[model samples]
Target: MAHEVPGTELNINTTSNDQSAEVGNAGGVASAGTVQAPVGTASVSRKRQGSPLEAENPWVIDIIREATSKQIHEELKASFLRGEPDMSAATVFFAEVNQKIQKANDEHGAERDRGTIPGDAYEKLYADFKTALEKAKLERNEEAALYVVQETHSKFAKFNQEHHLPEEWNINPDAFKHDSMPEVAPKPEPQDNDSLFSGSLPDYTGSETDIPDNVSTLEELEREARYNQSLSAGEVLYWWKRGVGTQTFVQYGQGSSKTYRIRAGSYEVYDPESVPRILSSGALSGDPSSVSCQGKQKLQYRNEKGRIEEAWAYTRDQVRGIVGVGWKVDDDDEEGIEPLDLLVPEPYATYPHTRILVLWVDGAVTLEDRAFIRRITKGSYLNVARIIYHKALRQEIRYRKAERLPYEHLLDRMPTRAKEKQDIELGDEEYEQDGEELNSVEEVQPEYRGSVQASTIRSASTRPPSNHGRSRTSEVRFVEPALEPRRPTSERGTARPSPNRVPHKSVDIEDPRDAKIRWLEEQLEMSLNRNHQSSYDSSSRWRRYNRYDGRQSEVSEYTPEPRRRRRAVHRERVWDNWTGSWVTARRVY
Candidate 1:
């Protein structure tokens, strides 16, 4: 027969009948003894035999105790291969042990309630379990060390993931191996001076020979500077003197047109040479009258004592008057044309006859013919008057104002207005005013040299008092111009006022000091309203205490509410897994 123990699963067997009878008696005695045993004593004996925690789940403690480095490595490898990120054998082993410890405590509490265990039983068991773990750690065994290393690496990998650190920052076990060491390059030898600076030095001995002579160089530089200054000032006289001149003669039967050409930067002819060529080519033979000289003749002569002289002769006064009409020379032509004689007298005097004639027609010759012509004969330069014309068109005259001699105006004792008509007939447009329409110069005002004060006083006395100070002496108050005020056409409320209407007050007319004061007052009011609104809003957002009922209310003002007691907040530095740094965690009750 086999009989089981009271609180345990162990069974005892009897071998013979006598032994069975003795066992039965002993069982009865044991049963009676167990019932009479003290609760603390029974609990102590049960603990001595085996802990209830181990009895319930023995594998948890057995795995922790019997773990090896090889087993841990295999488990870690398997876990990695299985792609289990957060789970590991070491973490599981500790978790199960902790659960077993919690269960032991719960059982100890139940035993204490049934009067089987003492009140301090759970505490004593916890202390014993902690001692065992400490003993296992202090043993310096391979499995424990490997578990620590693996746990550290696992925590580091988790920290890397949580903190978003680079993967290279994580510990790699393979990197620690001997085969993973990197090779270092050998140190270079110190270089000699010759080897360091390998290139040859430049030869600077012959540099002085490249310099030029100072006097000629300075003259050339001055010439260049003068040329550049002339260019910058746009002095056409300089270019005109430097220009080359030529002549083209086209004869059609007894009539011919002599055109002049001048080349400064470009070629400019007095008349188109192609017109004569085209007409002489028989293209216009159908109209023979178009080729008539029209009382104009081109006379060319050369005397034995004088140079070649050319002139355009007009047989009729009407023909001469028709040429170069309504044209005038610029006021600065004296400076532009006279400077060439002083600068280059030889060239100015001995230049080609054709060039001189072209210059005269172009209104560029401010001097007399004697300055440009070497010798003059009656027939050599006959019928050549001081007539100026456009450089590009022979018929368009360029008039110039006659030079006034000193005291020349004293000879004319007539009134200035009397001569204005004569000046207008002479084509003096400069004297014409812009806005005034001069229908006839004969319409002149009567000369009144009387005192202006007398006339002003008489005019002021006849006008009304309202117009006395407002009317200007220059303006006639008898007649007012007929101009109607414009009215706004739009009927909208936002229509702008008529531009002619004078506003009572304008922003442009407002005094800056008064405007600043008004602006400051408005800003002050706005700030006050803003502060009041903010206070009201903040008070509404939070709970407002009522003095009478000690409850929340809509009103912001309260009569001396009690101050809330401040609790001491416990602050501790805890490791933040996500941030991978220590942060202050606060606890308040």
Candidate 2:
């Protein structure tokens, strides 16, 4: 029991502690009062030096924190696993003992049967133990009360000594009270108007409380700051330029679909008993293409093992510091956890919630959502628009389920668990009989099989219907087999003429080599005859001139070699000996 502090209604058995502890419990540490570490941070004990209250009585807080932590751990574990203590047997045993005690009591210090302890003896021992436990508890509470009393008395004594009244005046209760009717104000002596500007109407032109056109109350101003668009000076224009934006957190499967608001350096210590500093911010930007960390800051958290950890603390600008080089060019795909500049404080429009708002992680916030969470007493569900930045288009696409066509949605609303075809391969088939087997499909011959060099020519032919309503069969129609046998791969030249082909007759039937010899002989003969005719004509001319004047007549300017073409000895041109006495053609080997 703790000594009660005056003027404070503090309860030691506080159940509604904090949400950071809730997050920790979800992580399996098991304390609802546990202060949460920052996102991506571990909790440590050293983080509490920043707190003045805990620094004074750390030991007391730690003791309570340990017990509560254990309690919450067990409770949450039971809740999750649905485990319960085995109390039935214990209760039954207790009842039996109580019955035995009662029976002994009814017997007046004697057992009804032999070999039994007397009721008086059993009752005395049990009652003594019970009384001792009750006494201990009572003494504890009394001690706590005594401490409270002492502290209260000491404070009052100190205060009284410092600012005490006269003993005679303060000793009596009636000293501070009115003993008689309060003295009434006496009537002023009859007098003429002594006031300045007398008989003149006072200037009351602008003193009247005339309501202004833009009359706004303090509450209305706060509502505007937190719930409505800004109505303050220059803020509306600033917001419009900033554009409407929302945030979303995607922590794999842990997203609660709830938004949060956090601030930087709220100085929340990371202890099981400390309040959690949320990992949220008021960062928003109409331009998805750009993020600005104009103002933001970082905070720290601790863990049970008492280690310090850090994370992106909080920021006012909504861009989440994406504009910072850390996010724009990190080594990894994630923009990652990095501190961003905090936003400047505003007068009234303050967001009040867990500042665990994460963009693209968990805790999504939408511009369409109310500016302030606490003031939102009523709401109608609105479409949640997710913004996707199309880098190539340099544009942001705002998409929501409500904007989709009905046909765009999938017919299967449930998740699909794909199974390999190998698993349960015959799930669809029914077993008609234990030994029955499926009919095997007909196998085609290798000849009928398609290949690179050949293909089975498919042909259709009508057949009479079977006895059934309609019948179908994959029948091979009569396709003419090729008449020509396939050429032997071993043969080098073209195929021999077909035996069925009629032979065409020609006058010459000589082998190609013999034909070549004969054709060359004929060509040589024709050339010789033409050469002989020319020679004869020249001789005739020469004889006519020379016969009349013997040797005196000179042969006209032409000379001729004695030539009858040599008998054709060879057909092809070949090289003759360079030094041969006579030039001669030789047949090619």
Candidate 3:
């Protein structure tokens, strides 16, 4: 027997013993089906001569097939003649389908537990099984019809043999039915459960008149774009295409939801970071004006003239004025674009005295404007532009209000020195030696502002005496000294008056020990006064009582001179010849 070509009416025949073969043509139909007896199980050669695609294929599998009408008729006739077939002889098509589905499901479950499947292949496999099961039923029923026809024929053949019935009786099984009997139509087999993915095709029906194309006349595209060009700012426009998800986004509360038609396969994809809530024009796709960015975003657009036009920042509710009160993100916009939470402009104290400068600025106050400031600072042209644009805005916003240093720019401009105490009373000679006193007021020098210093300029007369004051101390200052001509070193030696010696010639000189005692006394007096002030200022009584101060209070402007204590103890010295000690020379109270 020869094997037949699967779909076409072509047959190839060859005997295992006979190498040569004859090509038979029964109306160009293959003779394989008519050949009887196996030709020793000869293998069919799949070699094709012409096409590369067909040449290498070793197996040909047919996906879908149905019984032809003639085949169906023959099957019915055969089934009638055979009548009821032995249940064992009737073949069960796809008998292992359920087991295969269960096994696949078990494997799929295990894979799901192991997390190896890319998608839910189990569902697809199950669906496929259901589909295969239905196809198998069709094949089985078509094959079973032959047996039904065999049974019918046998029933009529018995009558033909017994009573010489006519041929019409075989063809028409219900020919002898009573007049009152109801004629019945074959019960229809259930069609395979409509495929799980039986979705209607997307309707892309529209006419050129619907959206009279723009640039139907323009030769090339240009940047001259307007916001309200396509659909008016608030108008609704629906759209769809193959790859891109269906329809322009719509805020459902608006009438656009009901007004527009929804075609099949519409979807919105969401992604954070990369995807903004309302994408501005020229962001991810198309021209800026093609889609409204929810109208809440502040976008810079160009008019027909090409000048950049800015829209003031808008509130979400305010955006409703453009897209209608229903202005909101799509239901699928969860991942797409989130709502905005503008950062409050809080000046971070990154720079020294930044808060003070910000306070000095008329209105600048928050960290919120940092991004805006940075953007402005990033000039399209040059870094110098960053300085100008942002600097101008900063000045407008009063970001850095540090005025021209408030004084002259000095050489060492960055130093910040502590303020020196003022108002100490000083005698004239000391002043004359240190530097010349200003005879009149002087203007602040530019160099002073630059760096030299901010010297405390309090008036001497206005300074108050300290609590321990013996003679009032002179107030100290750090002002720039007036320029004076320097004396020659040769002359400086003789011309420079010695601080301790008198200007005139003198023979007697003060003992060095006496100078030390004088200095020690001054230090002791200052220390005593400091202790007294501290004891008074301290809140703890124990600290005050423990001060151990034994000195006189100075006549300060704040306090009158205290009365001197009685001389209860006097210093007396007696020479101890054996110990060699002088008691009178000791420091005594």
Candidate 4:
């Protein structure tokens, strides 16, 4: 008799014929229905067992199907009278199911290697498995969900080992586990907005006796005491007035000894006891009008005509409509052969409010100007005074150089007035010519104006002037020997020639302008050579597009061809295998 296993297909044979019955008789337990097998002697022949996952067990199949549907129940019946399924049985069933899924993934990988599956097939499979795992989680089948997560992670690991994929492609089992757990809403935190202070408050029993008599209440007395204690050493009081924020003169030391000016709104730290008498007399005032103006007094200085003149000095603030104070050439004073064109004229009706006096004498600022400025500003505005003095000095120096004054040689390297004016006029002409070309070109294509202007300016700056059929004298002005400054004594020695200094010229022999023009021509020739070489190289590179049959071709003007007619033709060419020749069988239009 053979009895089948309850949950599996395997059968157990209890019928004994020879060896198993003799062994059962020796053991004193011989029975017709039940017989023990002898040691080392097999009674029933069973098939070789492989992995449990490879077996076609009925209970495994039923549990896997139930897990897939997420409808697992305790009283569910399995095939072949299998015992009631529990969590252990479900775990085993899911394990086998996971093995099957892995085997299917291996098949998919093989198909991918063979190029029979789509590139995203693995992705689709992963998404479907994830969906099933989520459904199991929602149905409260934790065992199936856990197995799904395990299989997904294992597949990810295999993919990483084989394909060397990025870490982002791997599945995070912890994330899914966290997602399956129940989520509790966060608790609200308590807020306290009633109190302004953080710790405990101090006790006040109204028994304090150290309060000042001037303060009426204890709070006011405490405030006064705190204010007094906050003052730094050497400071009796800090004073600041509201709304009167302009700069004002303040006297702080003993009468007429030390005094200074400070802005009104800013704080002033001083000892009031030191100047109590002055404070009592109310000498301090923030009014701008109260300050004395030293500019009202008239000062005397020698004029350019060797005569003393009286002029009133003024501070910078007193002047209105005055652009600046500097030496300027007089347009009317041109009677003398070497007329004193430079002068510091008196303030006229056009600028009547102007009062700052700028006096020039012997190609420099007069001593009277410095003395007057020092008297007006005392020592506070010396920097401003220095700046004004330098402005006047620079103007005078520039005027002298322009006029070719006798003392021009004493100055350092300076460009001649004619050379500077020529350079300026040339630059202006080049800029205007470039601008005209730029405007004309921009009329045709406005988008490329910026680039064209940049290239044009760069070329104009480096291009040498064309002198074809043009007189050199017209382009280069000749400066007379009388106008040239005398050479200094220091340059007469055997000293090395300076790179910046122009060569010394003989007084009666050669003209200096000839040498200058020759040097300029040499420089221009060198630049022209460089420009020609570069242009030749660039033209050679561009000539590649203008070649025809390996030979250079001239570019011609573009002309449109005249339109004539339109024609349509159809022809059939067939190969004659018998004659081995192509024949036109038919022609149609």
* Per-candidate count of clashing residue pairs (backbone under 3 Å): 3, 30, 44, 0
Better of 3 and 4 by TM-score: 4
> Which residue pairs in candidate 1 have backbone atoms (N, alpha carbon, C) closer than 3 angstroms, thus clashing?
324-397, 327-399, 328-399
Off by over 4 Å in 1: 1-63, 66-87, 109-589
Which should have the higher TM-score, number 2 or number 3? 3
Model 2 misplacement above 4 A: 1-210, 217-222, 228-276, 279-589
Model 3 residue 282 CA deviation in Å: 6.6
* lDDT value, residue 167 of candidate 3: 28
Give model 1 RMSD, 1 decimal: 39.1
| Cα lDDT tens digits for candidate 1, 199-296 | 56544455665653432576678778757654433222211223253322211111111222222333222223222321332222345544222222
Query: What is candidate 4's lDDT per residue for 1-589, written digit by digit as tens?
Result: 1111222122222212222221222343234322222232243222112323223222222223223332222222231013112324434443444454344334333221221112343455466666888688677777778888788767756653332222333455676776653343457898867667745665455567754445498667776664564342112211223343422223222211111122232333333334221121222334333212243456899999999999875543442211123221123122432211122121220111111322222112111233444443424343333334333333334334434444232221112244433533333443233221111111111132234444223233222223232121211223553323355547565434466866565456668899899999999998744422222223465566765322222332332233435766777899999999999876544
Model 4: lowest-lDDT 10 consecutive positions: 436-445
Candidate 3: list runs displaced more than 4 Å: 1-82, 87-233, 236-243, 246-589
Best by lDDT: 4
Between candidates 2 and 3, which one is better according to lDDT? 3
Worst 10 residues of 3 by lDDT: 351-360
TM-scores for candidates 1 onward, in order: 0.14, 0.12, 0.15, 0.16
